[model samples]
Target: MCRGWCWGCGWCCWAWWGRSPPSCRRCSTTGRWIICRPVPIRRGWRRSRSSCPGARRPSWCLCITGTVGSVPPIGRPPPLRSPRSGSGIGWSPSRGGVPAEDGATLMYPVASNGPGTDEKLRDAFVERVREVARSRGGLTVEVGGPGALAADAGKVYESLGGPLLYTTVGVVAVLLILIYRSPVLWLVPLVVAGVADFLSMGVAYGLNQAFGTSVSGQSSAMMTILVFGAGTDYALLLVSRYREELRRVERPYEAMKVALRGCGPAVLASSGTVAAGLLCLLAADLNSSRGMGPLGMVGVLCALLAMLTLLPATLVLLGRRVFWPLVPAYGSEPKARRSLFSAMGSSAGRRPLTVLAGGAVLLGALALGTLDLPGSLKQEDSFVDRPESVAAMRTLAEAFPGQGTQPISVITPAGRTEATIAGIQGHEGVAAVERGRTGDGWTELSVIAKGAPQSAAETATIESLRDRLPESYIGGPSAEQLDLKDTNARDRLVVVPIVLLSVLLILVALLRSLVAPLLLVVAVVAVWAASLGIGGLVFGPVFGFEGTDPGLGLLSFVFLVALGVDYGIFLMHRMREESLAGAEPAAAALTALRTTGGVIASAGLVLAATFAVLLNMGLVQLVELGFVIAVGVLLDTFLVRTYLVTSASVALGRKVWWPGRLSREPAGPVEQPPGETPPSRERVAVG
Candidate 1:
């Protein structure tokens, strides 16, 4: 390395003078030093004038100071040069060139076996990038672009699993403790739910391996939630029924069997409805949505099996002492109490039409909030907290306002490469065109658009390019997102009808009545609408989410409908049982609400809280989905199932069960003994 100060020009020049340049000389005109090695001129090198008549300065005298003969200050370096006209150091200091004084941006096109999908590959790539950057003294690297984004997203998902599981378990445990108010009782359900979750994971993974089903972090997390949420609901119903049966039956084993017999049909119906509804997601066009269908179904079914089998066995083994301090001893009747559910049932029964009309109007009003939801989410805004890749994109947007940093890839036939390039170059939005790799029969062209990435202008440009070059395949991150949005919309149209028909059939079979099934389906649909409306009202304004995820609507609808209907099943199944047990039409409705309302409320709380755990997640999509489902569950439990459905059943009388035996045959005479107070079953106390 050589360093010299040119007094006349007031500039400091640094250069690597290899081999001593054979000879060093001084220019007579300005007394400035020069390397007179007679080296051949390299590309981008220009010859400088020599004061010695016949002597020539070396072409490698690359100056870090200002241009030749300029008198710039010693500290300030020269301006950036174009990428082409410099020796790997002067070009725009950006466009594929690194300045001697600044940094450079390098783009690596990863292959199919790249870091985006593989954790080890991603880690190795990232580590290698850092190693290279570290070897270059004073240089730093920040990996960005589509590959980096995918890698970062993978990292977020990886981090999600442990924390999500722990939080969900803790939340469910606390709620179970509060609801059961028993030290030992909550443990049985919690352990069963945990086992169900793990079993679901194993089954889901097996299905993925066996069937080549795609699994994502989002789907797996949701599957865990379903196992715990739905399984616990089943546990609550069975346990509550077992407690009541213990008072009537002499032994715990007999009581457990009796409890299963009483609540087993409703549990089966609820789980079946959920599983069938989730399976409809298979009809979806989006890979994530379609894959989620089987995964979620497996979770629900695992939970059903665990609750109905393992849970019952565990409780029977534990015996009645499991409900210690408040245990229901055999033949010991519960003290009569006028509970909160009874009060609500009384209100609904008093003015069935008024209550029904008010609930409908309220739900309809909430559904209007859908009009205010934010637009479809952008990839950059998907995370609750911005990651480095998104930050890099923001910087690129600011640094290059008129040119896109990401390329729009176009593949055309090799024979028509020139014509395709010419056609793409003619577009107004195109900033530049570079011919990329050429293979056996195709040529890839990288087109830089004038508009920023993911902006409307860039999207339109991509569309226009696709339209103009029908023979070429156009794709990139933006184009893929465009396709995703379109696919999701299409899936909604196709899958919604299938989910409705499937769930409706299950409900019809469970209720054994067309009218009751229709009422429950409509109620759940209204709940979905209202839940989304509430999301619209709160997502942007309260949570500060910039845009709604494109898949939120479809995902939320499936979950709310599937999960929401479980509560309705519990209520309606109990109501049907009452009607068959010789209760009057109005009495059956009130009795159903009163007997099952506490259990439904507790179950709803557990399910909703389990989902609310998603609010603690790092993705905006999960938060939004969690919020909508949690809110929907609460609304369905307290307002819709407790008040609206009860009132509607009361209003319709036997017609609520139209065409069923209960609707056709007259109610049998009351079977109560002369002194017994109608044998009202003791509802589980949530408080």
Candidate 2:
């Protein structure tokens, strides 16, 4: 509506004038020049498009540039800024105060809702800071801080959203095709797994909302991995058994029923063990670990339900066609392939003692790698690939050494606010103190540490402050990390025993023997240790990870112990069935390995591959978790379940089932023809 004489170029409303930096292009939102303050742009200054200042950096604006190719707005209102991209890319005087000149850096900090957590807040704060920088034109504005980094990372994460799911599905689909040797067979399992995934999400969301469960990207990703990984394992065992039962039973429904009866106990036991093990995370003090307990359980239970109900129903409906070219005709026996498991069983059967000893030595050696694992992970080093927050933090570390960027928030009673601040001020490492918002008899204080955030010095300062002011609560990323490490330590003490006890109870109930259950538990525990040892040896050396996730020990122990026991259940259950049906100890052990070995191996592969998908994620925690779990699953599948456990069972004879009826009562005497004498026990043993 009105126009006036602006700075140097033409008529404008604000009368702002300055030399525009050549490196600073016109703002994308309004096509306006940004006057980078203090220093003029050098000919080859590195131009980064992400100079949008948020509360932590210099302030800026987003008006059209008068000197650019596009005409600056003369009378029409400024263009509407896009909340996504148009952050503090431009600067103006009217908004956030004047930007500091070169060598006069300002300490402005914005309270972010966290990167990728709130788009609107991120944009608004970035825009506000850009305006402050724009107010002082020609200066090389320092548009940086933690908020800026988080915003950039958030954008990147948002862009990569849910594509991971598609990638995972595709990976699993190919593996299934190879495993089943039927394109059509993979589809039913994928559909069923997908349904389980969606249902788990809803259940996870409900848990998050109703119970305030913490649902992070990492946990959600792990949940998906579990659903597909464990879900497919269950599906594989069921389908493999179904194909076998079909040869004996005429109808698909009858085959399905008989198949369920045969393998269902093992599958049910496996899922139950995993669910119960994960639920033990409730004992964890860390919010993430505690929340993961329920979320993980939900994913596993959902997968279990899908595999049991949907997969079976679909397979029964599709019947013979699902098998396609490799179809197992009703009344036709499965093709006999000399499988890898059979070969392994042969080796174990030949020299059970030697195989058992060598396997034990190998595992023990690998377990020693645990000593070489990197230290606890730093907050900034938590990601597999550095995100914007990490970059900003790095830049800040170099630019402003010995200064903390994130605030140490202290919540104290309103009446004790002054005393808390005084105590914090007197603390050794504190650099500054700023009083903040107050409400409901509580006062919030932001304390700045002289040392960099999460530094040893900063950690010391935090501990000092917390100790002195017992009533005041101190929290931030640094505090959270420390708490995570400490709480995980405590959780391991409480949860590991619970998990072991729970798994042992489940195994005893399934196999119905003390020694058998103990053998399975000890085998899985050793596998977990050896798996972790492998992680320690390779995480830093091979993958370049500097530190292990704090929860790595407990989480890996729970998963490897639970999932590893899955294959053991299949093998052990088969051995128990054979023992009761009439096979002697050594024969039963070998027979179990021969008959059920292929299916268990297949199940292990599915589970291992599913967890390996986490290696493709962004965070180092997922990568480590994925690597260890995958390795452990494979170990359980091939080495432990196939050789070690089988050898132990064979070597121990009837004592393997100690105190059970199968152990106490030898196989019933065979009734022979009148002319035939019963074969001696010693003769049978030699045979």
Candidate 3:
């Protein structure tokens, strides 16, 4: 049962089903409108008297332009019995009214009734409308309003699931083929990542069903990307190490064990850092953000499990021939060449101060573009390609410039209905008031403001109404948006600090150096700012986006900081290992950069490419998020990790290990291979 407010003739009507007489009567002011119509599957379809048996008929009445009118009950239709003849208000409705020449909108002055029946009703309504339009050639139909918009958004998400999955798989497959250059070897990790994705979906579903965690379309899609992106990264590190070990260890199983032993700590720390950073989102108040925290963490964990356990088992079973074309022969030395990473490291080591300053200045300059970012995105501008619902909203806004099209609902305790009405009657922004459904100890009043929907005046009016009627619940589409904006803002303040602290802690623990962790954290923060600044500059001018998504900043910050620190872990951990093996500080820094640089570069490309898939998504928010993170990952990979971090390590020398025993100790005895003597400290140090 539902009640609705019609803006066309300023009428309040009730829709319901039962047997009742066709007659006109005066309705008591104390009475309420209840049991409204569900959007019909077919137009002009009405229930007959015999359809409902042995049930009491609920009474019905109408308020048209402030005049009392009696309307025929369910199963009967008569021109609205003219309102008690003496009332001056007319029932005339024209083309300029709410019902256009061929179309009309159904306005429900209530919040959504969850996702069950309300969702189906909206879907049925749209299907029926489109069916009619198709049958009657030249007739156009569009479903708009809050209910239809939600239904459309849900539909868009449903459609996106297939394409998003396919595109992500396709992108990862191509990259893996290029990276592995082995027909059989690439298949192993790809299949492993796919299994991890499937596992994440199952686990995420169980979590949602068991714990009542919110699962939105956005979060679900992001989980898939993380599974593949982060999973593949772990796989690459393991595989690269495994291949290196294969050349040294004679047996396949022994080689696999050796590979895992070498890279296992780095993989575990990297995934843990990502999980901890994402989990910080639990501090967020927004349902999507908070929910995404656990869901994303689940994805990373699943990937980590697959890469460590399943991937190693599969590779050991396949043996060395898995890399048939370029199989690593036992005891054969790997090609010794001057790789690009080696050249880059040498440059940074030679001029540490110059490289560090230049990188910092570039990031700071890029961050200045944040000033150009547009305002929070409007609901009408959420989609990358405007749908019919958005078009209809635009038309309504233009047609109804001065009057609010959507009502502001004030649900008060039934006992306090009169007091609420009295307070609302003369409110500053209100233009008209219509009493709506009453039941379950609550009474709903639909107030139409003088200001158009979502305007400054309307927002002020909603805020004022909430202040005036403290006991009543003031809400509607606009109010919901207001709350969303406020909640997102609040979440940023609470979640940002938690994310930073958590990631910093993970880095400090893994690297065992206070200064190194601080440097990594500061560098990633700089990358986030620069990425967002680039988004601000491009989103408006190049992409033609209306405005930025409200949650973009918070989500991007969490991702960039967490994922960016991943490369830092790879480089710093390797550098630490070199230092412990008795290498000089500058040599350790340069060697670490050269050794891990290729893997980090490859992993960064995979992560960035996976997120770039979001650019193809329909929502402006997804596109913006994908763009920022993708750009940040690239910046972190090619610029920050390569130059700034390496240069800082070179310049700081032993102090990069700060207060750790390595900072105070001289180079320990070198572990040289048989018959190969260690180089002198003078030969290894930069300049």
Q: Which candidate is the best by TM-score?
A: 1
| Winner of 1 and 2 under TM-score | 1
Provide the lowest-lDDT 10-residue window in model 3. Answer: 23-32
Model 2, 58-100: lDDT tens digits are: 1111222222322222121232344655432222122122112
**Candidate 2 Cα misplacement greater than 4 A, ranges:** 1-107, 111-161, 209-212, 412-422, 435-444, 669-687
lDDT of 3 by residue, 1-687 (tens): 011112111111110011011100111111010111222211111122112122111111111111112111112111122223321211111112243222333221222221223333445444443343334233233445565566566666766767888899899888888888878888888887877776676566557557766656787778888999999999889998888777778877777777777789988998899999999998887777888899899989989987887778777777889987879899787766666888999999999999999999999999998999988787778888887767766766654567677777667777888888888888979987766656556776778788977788999999899889877777666777777778788889999999999998888888888999999999999999999999999999999998898899999999999899988998899888788878889988888888888889889999999999999998898899999999999999999999999999999998988878889885586675432223222111010
Clashes of each: 3, 25, 5
Ranking by TM-score: 1, 3, 2
lDDT of all predictions, in order shown? 0.72, 0.69, 0.72
Candidate 3 ranges with C-alpha deviation above 4 Å? 1-118, 129-140, 667-687
Write down the lDDT that model 2 would get.
Answer: 0.69
**1 against 3, candidate with superior TM-score:** 1
lDDT of 2 at 18: 15
List, residue by residue over 399-418, the lDDT tens digit for candidate 1: 45656777777767778889
Query: Every model's Cα RMSD, please?
Result: 19.3, 15.6, 14.5
How well does each candidate superpose onto the true structure, as a TM-score?
A: 0.82, 0.78, 0.81
By TM-score, is 2 or 3 better? Answer: 3
